[model samples]
Target: MSRKTLNLDSTLYDYLISQSLRETPIQSRLREETAALGGPAGMQVSPEQGQFLAFLASLIGAKRVVEVGTFTGYSALSVALALPADGRITCCDVSADWTAIAQRYWEQAGVAGKIELRLAPALETLDALVSEEGVDKVDMAFIDADKERYDGYYEACLTLVRPGGLIAIDNVLWGGAVADPANKSADTEAIRALNAKLKEDRRVDLSLLPIGDGLTLCRKR
Candidate 1:
C-alpha cells in the first residue's frame, strides 16, 4: 500500500469550500450520521459539491436523476432535496453495508420516498436502465463510483441522460494524478483515458472544473 495521501492542500481546500459552499441543517445532520457509521466518512459528498449538484439538477429541471455511487446517500439526498416535489432519484451501489446508512439518512431527511436504492454493480444497473424501455429518461446523472470503471459509467450515463442534460463525473483528477505523468496506477490511467475520450466525444459539451478532487461536467449536445 502506498503511504501517500491524496488530499487537497488544507488552505486551498478550505478556501474553495468556503467560497462555493453554503451549509445547511440537513448537511450538518448528514455529516453527523456519516461519522456515526465510522468506516465510510469519505464517501460523503462535499458540501459545496452537494449544493452545486442541487443547482445543476434545478438548472436542467431534472425530474428523473441517477447517481452511480450512493455511498451512504449524502449526494443522493443533496440532489433529491433540490428535485421538484415529484422528482425522483435512482441510486446505484454494490454496498449493502453503506447503503443501509443511506437509507436511514433518507428517511431522516424525508426524501426516502424520492430515492430508489439498488444494490448491484453500478455498470450493470446502468446498462439495464439503458435497455429498459421508458427507464432511459434521466435528466441528470452523477458518476462517482469505482475509478477503474469511470469510462464505462460515462458511456452508460451518456445513453441514460436526455439530450442537453448534464452528467457530473466526480474524481476525474484522481487527486492530481491525471496531471502527473509518473503516476500510472489503474485508476489514474483509467481517468486519463476517460478524460481524453470525453475531450473527443461529440455527443457532449464538456468542461473540467478543479473542484473537490475534480468534476467534469458534460452536457449532452
Candidate 2:
C-alpha cells in the first residue's frame, strides 16, 4: 500500500532486473572484469544505472558530454553507445591505471573514438574546458569524482553546460549516510551539503532519484 518509491529487497530487485535490464555482452564482460577487482569494483555504476544514464543522454540529445570520473569507463561506454557517431565525451580521471582498463574496454566496445581520456585532476581538466572552449556549450556533464570537490565540479559544469543541459551527480545519498547527522566523514559532509544547496539553488531543476547509490539529476535553467 505504499505510494512512494518501492523499497527493493533482493527478491524484488532480482525481479526488476529480470524484467527491465538489457545489458549487452560488452557491458557484461566489463562488469565481470570490474567485479574481479574485489572491493574497488563497487565504484562501478550498477548496470541499470548505466542504462538510465544512456537514456537521459539520449533524451537530451547529448553530443558533447563531460565526465568527471571514468573509472573502468562503464558509464561512459553506456552513454557513448547511445550517442551518434560524431558525438564525443571528455572523460576526466586521475588514474592512468584504471583508465587503461577503461581504454581497453572502450576500444573493445567500439566507442573509443567517442571518448577522450584526460589523465589529470578533474578540476584542472574542467577549468581548462571553460578557459579554452568558453561557456554554455556542453550538452551534459556527469560528476562522480572526489566528493570534497563536488561543488567545484558542479560550478564548473554549471558554466560549461548549456541552458537546459543536465548535470548528473552520482552517490548523492552516499549509501544513506547523508540523512544521518552522526556520519561526519568528509565525503558524507560534502554530499550532505551539496544536497541541501541543490534544494535551495534557483538556477536548476533538481530531482534526487533513488537510483543506484542515489543520483542527483539537475537540469540547468
Candidate 3:
C-alpha cells in the first residue's frame, strides 16, 4: 500500500478532537448554521482545519489572500480572523444563495470588512487578479471549489501569490477515493492527475495532509 498513516477509527478521531480542538463562539455558531442547512453542509471544513488555516496564515504573516470557494464563509472567516486589520481577502464563488448566508455570518463575526466576494466563475476572477492586481500581490490562496478546475485554479494562484506564499488545495484525496483505481469519475481523475503532476512539479514545496478530505499545501518557490 506504501501509505504509513494510521487508520483513524471513530474513537481515535474523537479522542484527537477532544484533546486539541478549540471552537470559538462565532465559529461554532457558523458551523451550526451551516449544519442547519443540511444537504451539502458536509462541505464545511472541520473546525480543526479552520483553526489550522488561521494558524498557518498568521505564522506566515499573510496580508492578502484569495479564496477560490466561499461556502458559508467558514474558511474565509478562519483566514480573515487571523489577518491584520488592514489585511484583505477576495472570495470567488458562484452561488449567491450560499454566499448570502456566508455574508450574514461574516457580518456577525465582524470580519466582513476584510472579505470581498466576487460572484463569478472562479477561473475568470483569478485570471483578472493576475492581470489587474499584478503578480505576487496576494499572500496566500485556498482552493476548495470545483475539482475539475483545480489545476487552472492552482496555476492562477501560483501567479497571484508572492513567491513563498501558500496555495492550499482541498479534496485532493477525495474521501480516499483518489487512491482507488475503481473510481474513475471526472472529479476523481482530475484530482489524481493533479496530485501526480504536483509530485514532479518543482515550482513549489508540497505537503499533502490527511486533514478534512486531504488538503495539499503548496508553497511556491
Using lDDT, give the best candidate's number.
2
Q: Could you give candidate 3's per-residue lDDT for residues 1-221 as a string of tens digits? A: 65688888999999988998776788889999999998989888888899899988999999999999889999999889999999999999999999998899889889999999999999999989888999999889999999999999999999999998999999888998998999999999999999999999899999999988999999999
TM-score of each: 0.89, 0.98, 0.96
Ranking by lDDT: 2, 3, 1
Task: Give me candidate 3's TM-score against the actual structure.
Answer: 0.96
The regions of model 2 sitting more than 4 angstroms off are none
Clashes of each: 0, 0, 0
- Tell me the whole-model lDDT of each prediction, alpha carbons only: 0.86, 0.94, 0.92
Q: How well does model 2 score by local distance difference test?
A: 0.94
By summed lDDT, the worst window of 10 consecutive residues in model 3 runs over 1-10
Q: Tens digits of per-residue lDDT for model 1 on 94-189? A: 999888877887887888999999899998899878887354488999999999998889888888888888999999888788999999999999
User: Candidate 2: TM-score?
Assistant: 0.98
Candidate 2 residue lDDT tens string, 1-221: 77899989999999988899888899999999999999989889999999999999999999999999989999999999999999999999999888898999899899999999999999999999999899998999999888999999999999999999999999999999998989999999999999999999999999999999999999999
Winner on TM-score (2 vs 3): 2
Q: In candidate 3, list every pair of residues with a backbone clash.
A: none
Order the candidates by TM-score, highest first — what do you get?
2, 3, 1
